[model samples]
Target: MTRLERKCPICGKPRAAEHTPFCSKRCRDRDLLQWLEDGYALPGPPSFPDNPQDD
Candidate 1:
């Protein structure tokens, strides 16, 4: 199948045109909530405001 017709990334169901990558609003909102809650994280050095190196 074409890339556009791939299954939903959230539930592995057939994707809807409206949601594009997700099957429905439920999955779409779920993904949004994950981002809002910081469910995804990127690797980075720990940042601290107390560092005194700033001049």
Candidate 2:
């Protein structure tokens, strides 16, 4: 049986067992940074301010 190869989401390189979905620490860290900096986001309705005065 042939096993399917998984590639890194960030660089398209073959994934490592240590990184799982990423090729290396750098790629993993980059993915984390993207989430931290809002480079990626989930689809959702616009949020409204709890305090109308703030708007």
Candidate 3:
């Protein structure tokens, strides 16, 4: 197993095995809520072309 210290994106706490990238269940749930509320978003358009015929 690897040992790495990463700050949680949700609460900015130290990450652990149980949460992984999140510090705890609460932070994980908070991140999920943010995602559900559209706080996070895709940066660009879909990979496929709008018109397949054009490709």
lDDT of 3 by residue, 1-55 (tens): 3457668877677887888878899999988898999998888987888899986
What ranges in model 1 sit over 4 Å off?
A: 45-55
Query: Highest lDDT among the candidates is held by which one?
Result: 1
Cα lDDT of model 1 by residue, 17-37, tens digit: 988889999999999999999
Candidate 2 per-residue C-alpha lDDT over 1-55 given as tens digits, one digit per residue, 9 for 90 to 100: 1223878899998888888779999999999999999999889865776787976
Clashing pairs in 1: none
Query: Which rank order by lDDT, best down to worst?
Result: 1, 2, 3
Q: Which candidate's TM-score is highest?
A: 2
Q: What is the alpha-carbon lDDT for the whole of candidate 3?
A: 0.82
Prediction 1 global C-alpha lDDT: 0.88
CA shift of 11, model 3, Å:
1.8
Using Cα atoms with residue i matched to residue i, what is each candidate's TM-score against the true structure? 0.72, 0.77, 0.64
TM-score of 1: 0.72
lDDT of 1 at 21: 83
Model 2 TM-score, 2 decimals = 0.77
What is the lDDT for 36 in model 2?
A: 100
* Best first by TM-score, ranked: 2, 1, 3
Give candidate 3 misplaced runs (Cα > 4 Å): 1-3, 46-55
